[model samples]
Target chain A: MTKNKNNILSTENLAIGYAQKKQQKVIASGINFAIKKGTLNAVIGKNGIGKSTLLRTLSKVQKPLEGTLFINKKNSNAYQHLELAKTISLVLTERVPESQLTVFELIALGRQPYTNWIDSLSKKDLQKIQWAITATNLETLQNNRCSELSDGQMQRVLIARALSQDTEIIVLDEPTAHLDMHQTITIFELLKQLTKTTKKTIIISTHEINLATKMCDELIVLSENKIYTGTTAALIQQNAFENLFASKIVKFDRALQQFVIHSQTF
Target chain B: MKQKPYLKHFILLSVLLFIFFLLNISQGSVSIPFKDIFTTLIGNTDVKDSWQTIVLDFRLPKAITAIFVGSGLSICGLLMQTLFRNPLAGPFVLGISSGASLGVALLILGSSVFGGFFLTNSISNWSLAIAASLGAFLVLFAVIMAANQLRNTMSILIVGLMFGSLTGAVIAVLAYFSEATQIQQYLFWSFGSLGNLSWSEMRVFGSIYLVGMFACLSVIKPLNSLLLGENYAKSLGINIKKSRIIVLVITSLLTGVITAFSGPIAFIGLAVPHLAKMLFTTSNHKILIPASAIIGGMVLLICDSIAQLPTSEFTIPINAITSLFGAPIVIWLLLRKKKITI
Candidate 1:
């Protein structure tokens, strides 16, 4: 629980959930974790187990039920809205709203928090947008409308948008939700590459536990009414993922080093 | 920046709007020369007295009203569309017009409640605007509340339609209880006209229109961010609740005031934004706002000119011509593009 100066974002005993009808609906609670600089981290859990909730709380999208969140060693609540935006960005799983925006235009919208009143792009913002397009390999699609892109391509566009924000930390919610296997790997690899190249901390809540294990520097596992935060190897050694599911259909296999079907038919 | 081509498109729209302004001003029975119209607009007194009176007092105010109603409603359409992120979102589609209609209907038809004070000529104009705005504001507030409750944008459209029907039912009940002249007064307002605004009314209307338009300008950045979806907009540091309130308030202001002054004109608000989006081929509100405003003004001008063409005893309600001309163009654009994208 020691606060590291290098820790870009950290949470203390965070209770993550939603408020329903003026009552706290605690989906998950008593969670504590910290994310260091320039690391690729993933939050993995069974469906509806509050991985998204925890990520949202950690990113300050939703308020914590009972905890403190710090960014850059400062209480998250102390920073201004735009100041926090410059610190953390998000890649959402929500449907991309219909628009006449081109791939380039869509990504450029990410710089809104940094722009002037009219939202015009500065030279630095323009350069970052270009770099994002090149980084995610969306250069050819820059002129095409976002509506015309395939699901996989749109996911990359979302990442590029987060990149152009130029935040120190980026959080994504199931970026590869609707992609094919190849596209999924491409997204994971792109995320890892982005962290290495830009030195930005990335925390994605994903269902691809195996892919996360293979690519991420750390994993935050939400399961068994407990929160486990550590490197993949360390979590594996500690059996952090044994109770990820209620029915116990899948288990962590030592030989495979990934969650696999323990029974032929469950 | 990929702004050069879009700038050219904006210039082209502006030029077309200017030409249509001349064409519209040159219409009507006396048929003033385009040159005389220009001179009259420039404050030159050399023009004939009759021409000056007709141009300045009648056609000029009507033309300005046409431009205001057209551009104002279309801007409201763009705001609603972006706020809800639904292509079908517009003042009329979302029942904001119905709200205004119900307000005006209540004022005109249900004036018995206020002992016919609402029908007084001297005070009716201001009263009508206030009533329309209040109605538009209430309906808008309800619609926004409903939209906020629902996460799915399409459901917001459905809620808007439901509100439209609800207001229609209320107006019908008011009509059933009213005298014939009251019904006619309400009917006249409902038919929609761009030619009835007086100079005094326009002075007030113009100021309100400018206020709403400037409010629209102030929110362009937030509207641009909203195109990606609200959660992402929030992440981009947009105060979603504040922007939502601003958009809804201006929408109600423009929609209510335009409906009050011009009698609930339709189609311009719904069709012009699509036309602008297609012409500019981008969704940046910075361009779409101006593009839609100009195109809305031009389209309404063309519709107004067409309405004046018969020149006989028979008169065409502007509401009819707008839909007759506008609906087909939107359909053709959708079919030609083979998509219904915003």
Candidate 2:
């Protein structure tokens, strides 16, 4: 078991699942990992391969069927709702508002846990909000309405919201899902800066495995019913990515740093 | 970054409410002196008993009821809009108001069905309140159940509208078979009126509204988190299920109480919240909720005053007046831009 006092999150023999009235469908089992403070990790897998599900489970967005997740070495289930909010922040990959909320106002929502019933912002809150806006390079867009923003700008605004949350850990689902090629690379670079500057654990899910393999400090690969995770160079050495694609048509090329499909003519 | 000028907007709205109150007290059927009205309001009046009756018993309760119902309806609308993530969502859109109308109809027409339940005329009002709350709660419950299965806000809004139309048809059927006098009473209730509330009824309504507003305030954090969508809210340590339940209960209580005391007043719920948002330029419920309440109270005060005018021999229905004030703003909004989908 990998145990560190500074670990922000650690999972033990986790079985992620969806709970209904009478049954639960476990998506994956025997999941184990530890996310240290000041680390950037990317969870990557094929479409419908449960990357999002595992990210959600780790973030406590849903219940785990069996095993336990510990935040700061305490059972995640033990934290009060408000207390949990103060500890971890999350960014979802969905369009949410019809209100003409500006980027600043949307970012201010990250301060909800600290605000009163009226959701007032204090001087410190404003300072933090300004820091987030500046961190995301969204100073000019502070007054612009979220509805008027491009998808790339909206994604940055979302990240700024998480930054304003001031939590030790942030889990985002496909934060770069809708961005263009340039925007995706910029976001990953921003994530790298966030990890080093904020000293916070940042976990995100993405389908851009090649980019993540280059930019992220560590990679979590979900395949079949197992998870393989380690530093990028270490994972490459272990051949963990070789079995990710279909056995018949594709092979992972370690030297060329890409996936190649060999013909079956022979 | 500097926050929006929320305080200035709030103060402006307060001033507007004060002005509207003055206007509301000015335009009754018998035009009392503004001095007398102002004195009476500030509790230094020695006016004649007849004028006092016209001012206090007749006009005061009516005016107060308008403000109370407006506050309740607008807050309810704001909550529904955020909860469903659709600005088009309103009190009636969710079927809560229609549900209350149905309950009032049943109480009026089904007295015989409940003849052995130790009921009396005095108890009928309480019974009506209970029935209205239940009706609203039932619809709210249905919506909550549907939300669990369907995540789309548009689909949930459609379900709510369908529930509204269904309940309206039921009320219409009950009205059809009732006695003519009962039908007239039902029709009057359906058209909406603030003048129907007595001072005693106002106390009951005031208490319910206070409780509902408190419940609404308690969920401000969760509600704000919701502005980012459910999964994000959940990650922020919000219990999405519990928050949704609290919002539903508060919304039902507010809508149910207003509809019970003042009938299913329209347009205020649908329009006032938007007016508040336009004025403030922010969607944070912390400001929007109170802002909407104030604007809603002002609009209803104006509409109720216009409703009391001696136009010919008949006073216009409060609902009609509210529609006149509300529908134009909505039409203007629709014609102006196609950017905001809700």
Candidate 3:
């Protein structure tokens, strides 16, 4: 009933892993971070650096091996499952429906948590669903089947789904994983706009470190068996953002504002 | 102000069902006049014994059985489609129907193994029902086990297909060694007929279907979330394991009973669900499930009527009628669209 101040999600010395495993072997242990509500945060790391694993753990899709994750200063485990769903909505990089599901119908799925056994969508629910579609610039596509949308459009549809869920914390795992450069920029801009307009904490993992560095308010970098979190400027100041990738082949050339793979030797 | 187009289709289908009911009552081998059929339904016909037997024993039970079997198979098909998240999934895909047939066959052929108590028993119907249910449930159990071991949908589907084929092989083996008379009886049953049931036999079918439908209604919420994926459903407070178990049980029950009474009437379960989805573009099970039930009932009734149209003097096998409509739809779906996955 009462909302906590500032911190939407905080991990304190947390170790995350699969629940089926008996022992808590940390993916990246002793990690501490707080995702403040209404902030647009980008989590950047090299592929296979456990960025997705960390995201899943923070979203409570998987259990942490050790330590605690708190929502509003209360233990996350204290929240009921549906309560958690109402608080934190997740968007995976999975495929959308290939069948003919109109955008309106797809977005309405977000209200499923509030629906009864009959899966009825009330007028209020419809209003929220329409709002999500409009916020994601999906008005024209509302009548179109998801199968008919472009990859970028489909990605927005998925985001609209999370928005319709009406959660305070929205977590997206590599939301821009399947898009062209133009589409990627479109999705990122939309993500930034959504964070500001909806005032929801947005945490997303991306491999596009350069774009994320320029666009995101805060950046969480996972590298070399450790995790680092700070604003993009602060991370650059601490020189911790430069070591995200191996330096031998490609180096982060801050002057150029991008990674430059070795070319002089060739 | 928005009206679902399918609502019109449903109403039209209902009208057609009424027409079929009338035709079925009047067009039997002992062609009762339309006037006589109406009088008979109104409990008149002067309480004549022969006419009463024709109405109650010959026509009424057969027509009701057609409606029930059609609706039941279609609902079972709809449930499988949603649960497996595959358009091709059906009651027999998971081997439940074959399992039922195997159980029924065992009773007809292997009953002598159970001694005289089984042979002279008045409780044979219940025993046959139980055996069929167990057989279907065994296949369901195997499918669930395979699902546990294999997480991929395609693999689970392949496993289910193999299980069905294996059940078919067992049935064929059993059929091979059975007495000629028993085989002949089973073969006739295999062709499928709604005419076999009397009014008393419908009691069990009605009760089982009611229970299955109720179970399905209770699960609409979980099923909607499941369309997103198991992980997504779990995130939404649904116990995915429990929901899966309940759905599997309900599908098995409906499929088993229909197969037990009417034999495995194909395509109604497989095709009707897809038809329901096409008519109603929403993925929400609330609309899809019930819509599939009614549409399924209508399609089956139509098919049953067609089966009865062997020049009106003889009945064609129901399976033959189903394959006529079913096989082409499957080919079109495969050629036109990629398989629907969750």
Best by lDDT: 1
Off by over 4 Å in 3: A1-5, A19-26, A256-258, A264-266, B1-5, B45-48, B111-126, B141-166, B310-313, B329-342
TM-score for the A-chain in each candidate structure: 0.96, 0.95, 0.93
Cα-based lDDT at residue A166, candidate 3: 93
Off by over 4 Å in 1: A246-249, B1-4, B33-35, B112-127, B137-163, B310-313
lDDT (CA) per prediction? 0.85, 0.80, 0.78
Q: Determine the C-alpha RMSD for candidate 2 after optimal superposition of all C-alphas.
A: 3.5
- Give the alpha carbon lDDT tens digit for every residue of A109-193 in model 3: 7887887667777888888998998889999888886778888888898899899899998899998987899989988898898
The DockQ of each candidate is: 0.65, 0.49, 0.46
Cα lDDT tens digits for candidate 1, A54-93: 8788778888889888888889889877888888899987
lDDT tens digits by residue: candidate 2, A1-266: 44888788899999987877898888889999888889999998888888888878887777889999999999998988888888888877777656667788889888877877667889999999999999999999898988889999999999999899899888889988878999999999998999999898999999788888888888899888568889888988887888887575767788878667788885
Off by more than 4 A, model 2: A4-7, A247-250, A260-266, B44-46, B111-166, B169-173, B310-312, B337-342
> For each predicted model, how many residue pairs clash, with residues at least 3 apart or on different chains?
0, 0, 1
Report how far off residue B100 is in candidate 1 (Å).
Answer: 2.9
Better of 1 and 3 by lDDT: 1
Q: Rank the models by TM-score, top first.
A: 1, 3, 2
For model 3 chain B, the run of ten residues with the poorest summed lDDT: B114-123
Q: Pick the candidate with the highest DockQ.
A: 1
Show the lowest summed lDDT stretch of 10 residues, model 3 chain A: A17-26
Ranking, lDDT, top scorer first: 1, 2, 3
Considering only the true interface residues, what is the Cα RMSD of candidate 1 after superposition? 1.6
